[model samples]
Target: MRYAKSADGARIAYSAGGAGEPLLLLAGQGNTHHWWDGVLDDFRAAHRTITLDYRGTGDSDRPDEPYSTEGFAEDAIAVLDDLGVERAHVYGTSMGGRVAQWLAARRPDRVRALVLGCTSPGGPNAVDRGDDVRRSLARPAPEGRRRALLELMYTPGWLATHPGPYRTLGDPTMTPKERLRHLVASERHDAWDALPGIQAPTLVVHGDDDLLNPTANAALLAERVPGARLCLIPGARHAYFEESRSVAGPLVLDFLREHERA
Candidate 1:
């Protein structure tokens, strides 16, 4: 892992691997740079993939305040700038997608193409997570709470078929405060008014059964962004890339290649 310093002097942790066009990956809320491990090799085969832990997650710093999508976007730009990467394709999942939207709109020159997976543009137009899902996030017991959260992310069929992912996923390294900060940041995310202004080619991908963010959010995102394409994986859940990367990975690669530059 390598380190980059944000404008605020925060130590942003990032890892770069693979070879080809640069692809910057922004992970979900409380997710570290390794969040894309499942599909890293696939991406590396075609692009130089860079992943980073959001401030307050993994090896990154935790400021004593709430986080914001705009703040995280700046953090991302900081990492890229630190690496001397002028522009690259960006892929964001879940809360990271919110950050990506803000980045593409606020700093269009830093982005080449965009991929938003299982996320929403916050505001009154967005649908909130269900009560059951919210309850699943509460911590009565750490293990049980994690299991509940996993249930919400993947379908029962998927769980039955893939019984070992939790072992590989382990647990998030975020503290309770960091989790709350991330949740607040995600809730406050509002990019609906800015989507139309994003000049990068965009792809919106989501599972058909994402209870946390919902598939409808994907449709709304794709519609709001000019010329954006939507790809809905049938019968998939919120963690589509982890649960079904065999399908989503190829689609993502194809999209990046379709817009790949010489």
Candidate 2:
């Protein structure tokens, strides 16, 4: 575990590994750096990956205040500064994608490229999660909440073949207070007015069957961001990376490579 001080003097935790061009991985709401474990091995083969626990999650210090996506972007920038990375290929999922977009917009000099997955541009078309899903989030993490959440994230075939890192989800170490903070952070995220400013070469990936953010959100992002391309993976859900790595990972790698060569 490594640490960086945000502009506001808040300490954040991050993990760095792999060898090649730097690629920062930002996990979604309610997720920690451990969320990238499934794809890190493959991603690391091509690029150095930096994963972090945002403020109020994982090993990071939690401040008593409402979380904002913009603030999270600042946390990311602080991480980059701490590591002395002048620029990096940025990739984010769900809320992390929103952060990546904000980072690209706010600090274009620090981003080489941007990859957004299972996220939205945060507007009228963005809040597509249904009442049931919202209710699930509001309630405390139940005994089977991990499995239930995974079910909502991945398709049936992927869930059947790979049950996923159940230990990571079911870990008893995560307290209810921590989980609540994550839930609040996720619920409070709104970045609709911030999309038009992202200038990085962008790739938007969304699952055709995603219920959380929906495919329209991806469309909105691609339509709003200049030169952003959208790819739809079939038979996948919110957790496209975990559910369809064979398809998603290669597509992301190809996009990064193409941008790198451009």
Stretches of model 1 off by over 4 angstroms after superposition: 165-171
Q: How well is each residue in 1-262 modelled by candidate 2, as lDDT tens digits?
A: 9999998889999989988888999988767888788788988999888999888777877887767778889999999999999999999998889888889988999999999999877656464788887676456666455556666787777668875454234224456676676656655666666677778899999999888677778888898888899899987888888668899999999888887734
Candidate 2 stretches greater than 4 Å from native: 135-141, 167-174
- Kindly give the stretch of ten consecutive residues in candidate 1 with the minimal lDDT sum: 163-172
For candidate 1, give the lDDT of residue 89.
97
Clash pairs of candidate 1? Answer: none
RMSD score of candidate 1 (Å): 1.7
Query: How many clashes does the backbone of model 1 have?
Result: 0
Q: Best-fitting candidate, measured by TM-score?
A: 1
